[model samples]
Target: MAISDVPPADCPPWLVPVHTLLLGIGVLCWDATYILMTRRALATKSYGMPLLALAVNLSWEMVYVFYVCEAVLETTGFFVWLLLDIGLVYTTIRFGPHDWKDSSPWVGRNIGCILGLLTAVGCVGHYTFAVWWLAEPGRGIGGDKRGKWWQGREGLDTTELAFWSAGLSQLNLSAGSVAMLLVRGHSGGTGYAIWFFRTMGTLFGLILDNAFMWWYWPAGYGFIVSPFAVFIWGTSMACDIVYPFLLWQVRRTELLLPDGRLVRCDSQPASTASSDHGKKKR
Candidate 1:
């Protein structure tokens, strides 16, 4: 039988705990990210993540929980994230309209339907990709036993699947975050905590995890260290790194409206205007 047909080799006893530890850190970091996002969303009455990025992330988790993931811990992690995503989605639908009220009334009005449609489409798109990728001959089947569990079975390469899909997801998230910050020009629905947790999540989950995997199983995980993977994660890291500085600049110009909306002031510095407005009210 070809190597692909052969049963996966056993995981090294020592590596099992190490594997769990690495993935565990990643999971915790991402879970914290979701929690912080939800909290910030509620506080500002607006959504934190980009709409398209959220849809893709929710769909990715749904697929892994039902169709892709094999390990118990992995499935559990995806499922937990899914539950948190549901809350985040609710926040988006509930408060997203207020943010879009002035710019695009129609979008604010039809936000729920748009998100439903996007989620459905994302599900179909992600599932189709997984089906084709896992079915291809000799694809995604070269790793160790843990590879079979954490990565893929037979030709079902969860790791590579996650890399491409999650890589695209991260790109959308990181780039969209910057775009949102600039477009909004205020600290609405976002904060330093969200950025920090999200950045650390990517660091642990994608960059560090892949690096460790390659160190442990160089031959099996060569694709992870390849140029393509590097580019995807590297671009995301660069975007994340630049986010805080931009946020600082934007915060300086922000004005807190009486109705709890945070907006930018281009005509004058926010501190001067805020103080003047306070004096007038007094």
Candidate 2:
């Protein structure tokens, strides 16, 4: 049989405790770092949209983790997580920065705005479908052949919702990263490191989740393996830990421009000279 046919094992011995520890520790670190960095940024007057973007992202991340661990898997958890997810998508789309004026008209602000709005709409639709499913447990829709909502069976409708949410989340994240990078220009320094790790963690979690689904397909009982679930817990913790360090660095550095954009420095001579001239003119 295919790997998808494999049965899931029991929850791994180290999974729950380790993940719990990581999640808790990460949140504490994230909180401490956020407060410290925010104060520093304000004191230095270097605060800008990027800081706001980071705050929104990290805040939603924390909430997402909380719901995942305490809410999503349970009956009420699903609704809670659904609402939080919707909030995240909306914030990312609405508050996340975009730099259209600097780019070609074809790939400029309008396009990015459209994409962001579409993504938000998609997320809302997915959540709406999920809410509907929850409201009417046995309504035939999508892959829900059995019409049982609480059993967590992967039906067409539920699967579609998962697929859409996952895809939209990725899109939202990518767009936000690109917007930040563009607004900040080249001097992002360790900011790039923060983005890199965050992106990697997200991608890693997604891969593990998809893998678990595949492995648990057919007659398999592999839900116990739960590699994705564990990865998410661990990644969430890592995000919390790294968030503070990155935010601290950002606050310490004079990285915001006068126009309220985050400044990025170029390393190469030509680009550096160009940036220097631009800074001087500004």
Q: Pick by lDDT: which candidate is best?
A: 1
Query: In model 2, which range of ten residues has the least summed lDDT?
Result: 1-10
1-282 per-residue lDDT for model 2 (tens digits): 011111235434443334334333433333333333333334323322242343334333333343222233322423443343343334333333333334444434344355455445544555465566545433432221332123343321333233334433444444444444445443222243444444454433344443444343422222223455445444444554455444544445434454443443432236544564334211
Compared with the true structure, the alpha-carbon lDDT of candidate 1 equals: 0.74
Candidate 1 per-residue lDDT over residues 21-135, each given as its tens digit = 7667878988998998888777766788888889888887888789877667777888999998977899889988877887798989998888888888989998999888777
How high is each candidate's TM-score? Answer: 0.85, 0.39
Judge candidate 1 at residue 125 and give its lDDT.
Answer: 91
Candidate 2: TM-score? 0.39
Sum up the clashes in candidate 2: 15
For model 1 the TM-score comes to 0.85
Candidate 1: give the clashing pairs: none
